[model samples]
Target: MARIASEALIERLAEWGVDTVFGLPGDGINGIMEGLRRHRDRVRFVLVHHEEAAAFMAAGYAKATGRIGVCLATSGPGGIHLLNGLYDAKLDHVPVLAITGMQETSVLGTGYQQEVHLDRLFADVAEYNMMITNPAQLPSLVDLAIRTAYARRGVAHLTLPNDLQVAAADADPYEHVAPARPPQTAPVYLQPPGIPRQEDIEWAADVLNKAERPAILVGQGALHARQEVLAVAETLGAPVVKTLPGKAVLPDDSPYTTGGIGLLGTRPSEELMEETDVLFMVGTNFPYSKFLPEPGKARVVQFEADPVRAGARIATDVPVVCDAKEGLAALLPLLTPRDDSAHLAKYQKMMAKWRSDMRSLENPDRDPIAPQYAISVVDDLATDDAILTCDSGTIATWAARHWTIRGAREFYLSGTLASMANGLPYAIAMQHAYPDRQVIAYVGDGGFAMLMAEFLTAVQHRLPIKVIVNNNNSLGQILWEQMVLGYPEHGVRFAAPEADFSAWARSCGGFGAKVSKAVDVAPAVREALQHDGPALVDVDVNPNEPPMPGKVSYDQAKSFAQAFLKGQPHRAAIASTLFKDRIQRLGD
Candidate 1:
C-alpha cells in the first residue's frame, strides 16, 4: 500500500461508503486514475464516454438511492462539463459530490493548458467548494465536502491538483471524518436536521381542520412523507395534487391523488385547485404560481424541510419549517377529521373521468402507434419494484400521465433543470447503484440519441437496465410547443437519417427489440426486462401527437389556431386528439 495522497483520498472515499464513481479518463486526472487502479476492488471506476453523462449518472444515483453521488472529471473543460448535471442535483436538492483533477501545483495561474478557475467556476453550484492545495488539507477537506453535500442536499466540489494527488501523504493527524463502514440503517437520511415546533404543527393542523375545502399540493421534497400526506388528505378530505417532480410521491391511481396540476397535469387537479378554500402545500416549491391558489382567496400553509425555500413562491400564511414527515406526524394528531367530504368526492369523480379519458387516449387505434399507447403498454409491463427515469420531453408527459407507481415503484425526474439526454445516464446510475432492482429509462428518440452511447456502458457493466425509447424521429415536445406559440417548428421538424437503434444495441452485446405495432409494446418491454444485460426497446410512435395542457388559455388557443391556419404538418391528427381531450375537459 503506497502512502500516496490519491490513495488516502480514495481510501477516505471508500470509508464514506462510496463503492462506485462514474467518470472518464484524461491526462489531468492520471493520478486519480492511478489511485482508482490501486483501489480497484473497493472502489470501482465506471468509465463513461462523456464527462456530462458521468455527472448526470451521479445525480441520478443520489436521487434514486438517497445517498451522496460521486462523479470525477479533469480540470478545465472536464470540470465545466459537470455543471449541467450538478445544477440538476442542486435544483432538485439531491446530494452529489464532484471531484475534478487540476493542473500541477507548480502552475498557480499562468493560463496553463486546459487551465480554468475551477473553484470560482463551481462556486455557485456547490454548497461546499475547495481546492486541495496540500496533502494535509486533503483528509478534512474531502470529509467536509462529502458532509456538506449530504447535509445541504446539494452539490459539493473538490479539485485535486495532479502533483498533490500522487505526492506522499501527510501524517495521520486527525481521526477519519467518515464512518469505518456504511450505516446499517434501513432507510438513511444523511443529516436529518430539524423537527417542527409543537405550536407550529398545531397551528398548521388547526388551519386545515377549520377550512371547508382544503387542497393538498405535494412535491419531490415530500417524497418520504406519503403516509403523512395521505393522513392529512384523509383528515381534511382534501384532494392531493402532485407537482411534476412529485409524480411518484403518491400513486396516480389513488383516489386522493388528483394527478399533476399544471401544463403536464390533469384538469381535475386544476379545477379542484381553484375551488379549494385552503391550500396545504407540503414539501414543494411548485414553480407555476399561476396554478396555485390566489393570494387572497385561499389560505396557504406550506411545510418544508429547507427554511430558505419557505414562502419562496406563493405567499405562505403559515410557514412550517421542518421535515415533511416529522411535521405531518406532529400535525396529524392535532387535526380532527372533516365531516364534509364534498370536495374530496368531487375531485375523485373528476379523477375517475380523467382516468377514463386518459385510457381512451392510450388505447387510441392510431396507425403510426400512439405514443400514449406504447407508454401505457410499457407502464403495464413495468414490475412493481421497478425504478423509472423519464427524459425531459413528451416522454416525461407520458410518464407523468400514464405510469402506475405502485408498491416500491419510483420515478427519477430531471426536475427544475428539465435537461435532455438525462434518462440513459440516470438509469445506468440507478442500475449500478441497485443491481438487483429493475431500472428503466423512458426516453424520447431525440434524448435517447443524445446519450445513446451510454447504453454501451450499461452493457459493459452488465447492469440489466431496460431503456424504452419513444422513436418518434422528432422532438415532439418542442414541435408541439412551437405550434402552441403560433410559430412554425422550423429547426426541430427534421428527423435524423435512418439508423437502426435496436440493432446497435445487439451489436454492443445487449438485447434489442424494435416495435412498430401497438400490440408489440407490452411484449417488447417484457422481453427487455427479462434480458440478461442492457436491453433497448425502440418503439416507433406517432410524431404528430401533442401533450394537451391541463387548461388551454385563450391566447394559447389563438396561437394554436393560427399555426393550424398556417398549415402545420399533420394538423388533422393533432386537432382530432385536441378535440377529444377538450371534449373530455368540458365533461362531455
Candidate 2:
C-alpha cells in the first residue's frame, strides 16, 4: 500500500487483470522494471528481443484469450518500434495496452536524450493516448485507458515520463474497475420508436415461403449470434454459406452449412449462390462484390449491426440495422417452418461432391509438390488441439482450403488486414501464451523472408514453434494474376539465391529441414514437432499451381486488365489472379 510511483502503476495493472506483461527493460523504464522485480510474484514479464515482436506477441495473446494484452517498451526508438505491431492490433481490433517510457517530464519540449513525441506518434494506432505528468492521474488514466481499449477493441498507449516513474503520489488509494459486461438484451432485437410494419415482416416471410432454393450467407458478426443464425437456417430449411471470417460460426459439418463462398470458397457454395433466387446476406460484408450475383436476379436481404454496412455491397430488398443475432431472432418467429427438406438435401449432396472432388486435387503423387498436399500431411501430423497461424498468399489459401479446425483448435490470422510477415511472430506469440498447445505457422517463402529476423526471437526464447514454409521462390498469387491478366510477370520472382531456411533454423540452435518431395513432408514435420525448441520445414512446392479454389468472371478480368495497363502492379495482380482460372474454365 506504499505510494511509490512504480508500485502504484503495477497495482493498477493487476487490478485490470493483466497477469502477463510482454516487454524488455531500458534505463528510462528502470524504475518500473525495479518495481516489477519487487512484485514479480504478482505479474509475469515476458521478455522479447524486439519491441515490435513484443507488441505482436501481446496482440496474438489478446486475440486468443479475449482479454487486454499488455506490452512495455523504453523511451524513443524502443517505443516507436512498437508502432507496426500496434497498427496491426488496431486494424484487427485486438485489445492491447502498450506502456512506454519517455524522457523526463522536466525537459518537456526541450531536446533531451531519447526524447520524442511518443504520444502524438501513437495517435493513429491507439484509441486513447496519454502522457502521465502527475502521479495522481495514474489511477484514473490507467482505468480510462483500460476501459477505452476494452470498449473500442483496439490499442491504448500510456506514456510514462522517466521522472514520473519515481514520483511519489500524495494518495495511494486505488479503486477497482470492473470489466465491461455483455449487453443484457441483444442489441438487434430492440426496436426503435417506430415499430416495424407487420407488412414488412409478412413480405420477408412470403419471399422465404415462395423461394425453392434460398441461400444464407453468414460472416464474422454471426459469431455473436450463432444460435440465432442456426435457428433461422433451420426454420427456413436453408443451406448456410459462411465467409472466411465466419468459418467456425456454424459447425463445419452442419448439414445446413455448405462452407465458405467466393474466390477461395468451395464449388458447392458458389454454385448454390448462383442458382438461388433469394440471397440473405447476414452479418457479412464479403468484400468481393464481383462474386455476388446480380441484385435484380435474386432478392437480397441483409441484416447487420451497423446501418451504413446494411446495403453497401449489394442492393437489398430488406436491410435491418440490428445485431445479426437480434435481427435473426426477431425474424425467426415470423418465418413458417418449411417442409422443403428435399431442397436442403440437394445442397448437402452437392457439398459432399465438392469436398470429395477437392480432396482429389491434393495429389499425393505429384513430383514437384502440391502445397495443398503438404498442408494435408501437416494436418495429419499436428496435434488435434494445435493452434494454426497462416500468412497471406498461396499458403493461406491452401491452409484455408485444407486445414481442419476442430472445436479445441484456435485459428489466428490478420484476416482483415491480410498482411504478410505475421505467421512466424504469431506462432511465437501463440507458443508463449499457450505453452501446452502445439503452435504452427504455415507461411510462404515470400512471407517468411519478410520477417525472417524474428526466427532468432523464437530461438532466444526457446519457443517450440513449428514453421512450415511453402517455398515456391515466387509470389504464387502474383504469378497466377500475371498469367490471367495477359501481362509478362516481372518483379514477382526472387531471383536471388534462396536461403537455406533449414540451415538458418539450425544456426539459431533449432531443428530445420528442406523438404523437396511429398513423401518427405510428413516426416520433416513430425521431426520438427518432436523438437524441444523452435523448428522450420522448408517445403518446395509447385509454383504453377493456383492457390484459390474457384474462378472469377469476365468483368473481373476486364477490371484487372485496366489496372495492369495503368501500372498498379499489386492491385492488378490480385484482380488478375482472382479471375484467371474462372476465365480459363469459361473458355473451355
Candidate 3:
C-alpha cells in the first residue's frame, strides 16, 4: 500500500527510536493526526492543553532521559506558542525536535489564513530549521532534524505544509540524479565519544597541583561524570560547587561538595569561590561573572564539550575541549593526590552551619506556613528515587536550599533560561518517562497559574505526579527583586479571593488539599504523596517572606531600604516579617 508523507514521517520517527510525541492537534495538522492514529500502537501521542507546555514537556523528557524529545503543533499561533519552551531547551542545551504544520504550499508567499513565516520565526532558536515542501523530503528532513538536534544539543525544527503532508511518498518523476539509497532508508547517526588531548589533561593537572586551594565547579554538562568529578575533588582536597542544573551531579551528602553557587546558592559555595586560588570548571559556562573568582586572582581551567564555550564565561588559563566524562577521566589519573584536608574541611564546616541556619528558618510553628517548611515536608516525604522539578521564582530558591538530592534522585529547573510555567509540564514528562517512579513539582502560585490547565492533561493521562504549590498570592520573587533593585513594589500582588489550587485539582479529577497552618504542612504533603493518582497541595505561605540571598551586598541593603522609604505597598507587613525572621535567626 502507498503511504502518505505523514505516515512515512511517523514510521521514520519510529525507526529513529521515538516512542512518544507531545503535542496539540489543530486543523492544519489533520493529516499528521491521522498518521498518529494509524501508528497508535507504535507511538504514543501525548495531547497537551497548550503547545507551550508540549514544548516544555519535550525538553523535560530530553533532560531526564538524555534523549531527543519531540513536540508537534499546528501552524501560525500554535507554532508561535512554542518559542519560549524551545528557547528554554536551546539555552539549556537539551536536544528537542519541534514539528509544526504550515499553510498549504500554494499560499507560501501570500499571507493566507493562519499563515506564519515559521522558518524565519524559528531561525534563532533552532540549530536546524526547514520546511518540507515535497513528500519526498519528509524522510530526509526528519533524519536531518533529528541528527542536528542530537549533534548540537539544541532544538531542531521542521514545518510540513498541509497539502504536502498527505501527498504520496514517492520520488518526483522529473528528478535528474539517482540516489545511493532508497528514499525510505535512513542512515544511522551516532555522535563520536569525544576524547581530550593528553597535553590538555596534563595542563589542567599541573594547574590543579600548583594551587594551595583549588575548587571544582560542575554543571549539567558534567552530569554523567559524577564519579570523575568526585575523584578529582578528593584528589585535590577541593570543594565541589554545582550550578543549579548540576545539583544532582553529586549527592549533597558528599563530603567534598559545597552546594550551589549564585544568588540562589548556599553560603558555603559562595565562600568556596572567594577563597580558592585555582578554579577547575568542569563542563560549566556559569553566566554570572560576579559569582566567579576575580579574573587575575585565580588561575582557571575549564573542561567543556563545546570548544566555543571553553573560556567564554571566565578567562581560562587552560581549556580542555572534550566530553565531561572523558576529559575528567583522563585528567584524574594525571593528578597528584593531596594530603591537605584544610580547604575541604573549611567548606564542610561552613555547609554545616548553613544547614543549621536553614533549619532554623524552616519554623513549623510560624502562624502562616513558612514556604521553607512546606518544601522541607515534601523533601522528607518524597521517595528515594523521586524526580523533582521546580518553576522559576522564590520556589527555585526554596527548592535549591531545602531539597536534598540523594539516592537516585534527579532535579531539574529552568536553569539557564529561567522560564516560568515549566514545573508542571516537566513533572508530567518525568512521570511519563518513569511510570512507576514518583515525580513531583515544587511550583510557586504565579508559575503554576500560568500553565495550571496542564493539570487536566496529567489527569487525562492518569499520571500519578504530585504538585506542591507555595500559595503566596503574589509574585514573591518579583516583589523581592523590586525591593533589592531600588523600586517600589508595583503590579506584583494578586487580587483578593486567592485561588483555590487544590479545588482546581479536585475539579480536574485528582486529589486535592489545602494547608493554611504550618502544623498541617507535613500531613497535607504526606496525604498528597500517598494518593493513588495525581495530587496538588496548596499551602498558604507567608507572602512577606523573602528569599534572602547567600551574600547580601551593602548596595542591595541600601536599595531595599530605599524602596521601603519610597512607599512600597505593604511596607509595614514586609518590615515586620523581616524583623521577626532576623530575631528568630538570632535566637537560633
Candidate 4:
C-alpha cells in the first residue's frame, strides 16, 4: 500500500515523538495542512497570528520542554518570517524543527508566485537544511530533520514541494526509523555520553583544594547538573554565581547561591567574582568578558560538555571537557571540603543585606506603581511549579531581581538573542506544552505591543496564560544605556495615549485589567492568575526608574555627568539609587 507523501511526513513527525506543532494555514502549505487534518488524533497544530510567532512559539517550546519543537509555514514570505525565531533557537542552543512548504518543484526558479530560495535563506540559522521533492526522501529527511535537531541541539529545516507533498509516499509501505536516544516521554531518557578524564578532574580538585576564595559560575547547561554542582559548592564552601539563563540553576534561597552577575545581576555576584582567587566556570558562556574577573586575577577551571565552547569566552587554566554533572561527581572524591568560612561568610552577609534592601524596593509605596513591587508580589504568589517567561529590557532586570525561582519552577529569558516581544510567544508555548502548570509572561509595553496580536492566539486556544505588562512608556533599558554613553535619549518614548492591552484582551474573549495605583497591583495580578482563561494585567510603571549596571566604569560615570549637565531628567535619581545600593551593601 503506497502512502501519500504528506501523510507519511506527518506520520514520521508523530513517530519522532512530536505531539504538538505551531503553525498557520496557507494555500502553498495546503497539502501539509490536509495531512495535519487527517492526523488530528496524533498531532495538534496550534494556529498562530504570524508565521514569526509560530516559529518563536516552537523555539520557546523547545527551550522549556527540552524537546524538538516544530513550526510550519508556506513559501517565500512565510519562510522568511521563520528566520528570526529560528535564529533565536540557534543562538540559544535549543532543538527546533522548522517545516516549510515550497511552491511546486516545476516552478521553483521561474519566479512563480510566493517562490523563494528557502534553503539559502534558512542556511545561516539551521544546522541541517534539506528539501524533500522525492517521495523516497520523505521518511529519511523527516527523521534527519528531527533527530538532527536533538543531536545538534539546534534548528533543523525541511522544505517540501507542494507538488510532492500529496504525491505517493513510496512504491512500498513505510517503516519508522528509531532515534538513537530515547524520547523524553520514555520511561528513561538517555544519560550523558561521557564524563571528564580522571586527570582533568584531579587537576581541578587540586586547584579548588588549594584556593581560599573559589566561586562557581553557572549557566543554562547547569540545569541537569544541579546536584553535582551543589556537591562541588558544598565541598569547597564556594559561593555560586549565575548567568541570566542560569538564574534558576540554583535557587536564590540556597546556601551557595548569589543570584546573577551581569548588567542586570546582583552586587553579591559581582563582589564574589571580583574577590575570587579561583573561579570554576561551570556550564555557562556568559559573553560579557568584562563582567568576569580580569584574566590574571582568577585561576579558571571550566567544566563544559561542549569542547567548542569550553573556554571560548575566558582564559581556561584547567579545561575539563565533560558533562558538568558527571565531571563534578567524579571530582568530588578527589576534593577536600574547606574549613575557611571567611570568604563564604563575607558574601553571605552582603547577600543578606542585599536581599533586605531589595525587599524595601519591592514594598515601595510609589505613585503609578514601582515595577519591582508588582513583580515581587508575583514572585510571592507564583506556584512552586510555575513556568515564567520574561521579555528583554528594564522589565527583564526587574523580573531577574524580584522573581525568585525554586523547586520545580522554570524561568526563561531570550538569552543571546535578547529579542523583544518574545515573552508572550514564550508564554503561549509554555501553556501549550504544560497546560496543567501555571504560565506567566512578564512583558514590557514595548515588547507586548510588538506581538500583541498573539494574545488572540492564546484566547483562541483557550490557553490560561497570565500576561503582566510593565507599561513603562519608554524603552527603559535603552534610555539608561544612552545616558551611560553621555548621549541624550532619542526615539525612546512612545508619544501620547499609551496602549490599553487589557481592553484588547477583553475584545479577544479573555479577561483584562489596568492597574496604575500601588493598591491595585497585587489584586490585579492575583485576579489574572486565578482567571480560567487567558488574561492580561497591564500596570503603569515609573519610566524614570532605571535598572543600573553592576559596576560603573570611569567612561560611564563621565557620560552620566555630561548627560546630567545636558539636563537629562532622572540623572541624579539614578546615580543616587546606584550609590545607595552599593553603599548600603558595604555594612554587611
Supply the TM-score for candidate 4. Answer: 0.94
Q: Can you write out model 3's per-residue Cα lDDT over 1-588, one digit (the tens) per residue?
A: 567789988988888888999999998888898888889999899999999999999999999998889999999999999999999999999999999999998878897899998989999999999988667666777888898999888999999899877887674534666433335454577886789988888988888899898999999998899999888888899999999999999998888888989989988888778888999899889999999998898999999988778898988999889999998888888889998788788889988888878888888888777888889898889999999999999999999989999999999999899999999999999899999999999999999999999999999999999999999999999999989989899999999899999999999999999889887888888989999999999999999998998988899999999998888988888888888788877778
Q: What lDDT does model 4 reach?
A: 0.85
Model 1 spans with C-alpha error above 4 angstroms: 171-192, 576-588
lDDT of candidate 4 over 1-588, digit per residue (tens): 345788978987887788999997888789899888889999999999988888889999999988889999988898898888888899889999999989898888898998887987888899899987577776767766776777677999999888888887662224464324333342222544758887888888888898889999999988888888888888898999988888888887887888888888988898887889999998887888988999899999998877888888899889888877777788899989888778888888888877887776774466647788889988888899998899999988898888997888889988999998889999999999999999999999999998899999999999999999999888988998898888777789888888888999999999999988989888888888899999999988878777866556688889978888887766666666555545544533
TM-score of each: 0.94, 0.82, 0.98, 0.94
Q: In terms of lDDT, which candidate is stronger, 2 or 4?
A: 4
Q: What is the descending TM-score order?
A: 3, 1, 4, 2
Query: Compared with the true structure, what per-residue lDDT tens digits does model 2 show for residues 1-588?
Result: 555688778877876677888887898799789768878888888777778777877888887777788989999999998887788788677789999998887797888888888999998899999998667676767877888887666899999888878877543334354433323331221223222345655666677777778889998666667788888888888999988767767766678888877767887787887888888888787778766776588888777655667788888887766567766766777888888598789889987776665576666676668777899888778887888888878776787677775556556776677777778878887787788999999998988887787888788877889999999899888776665676656778777686568888888888899999888888898999998989999999877666655545685567546656766545543554335434433433
Top-scoring candidate (TM-score) = 3
**Residue-level lDDT for 386 in candidate 2:** 86
lDDT of each: 0.85, 0.77, 0.90, 0.85
Lowest-lDDT window of 10 residues in candidate 1? 179-188
Cα RMSD for predicted model 3: 1.4
Off by over 4 Å in 2: 1-3, 111-114, 169-212, 224-228, 275-278, 281-283, 293-334, 482-485, 555-588
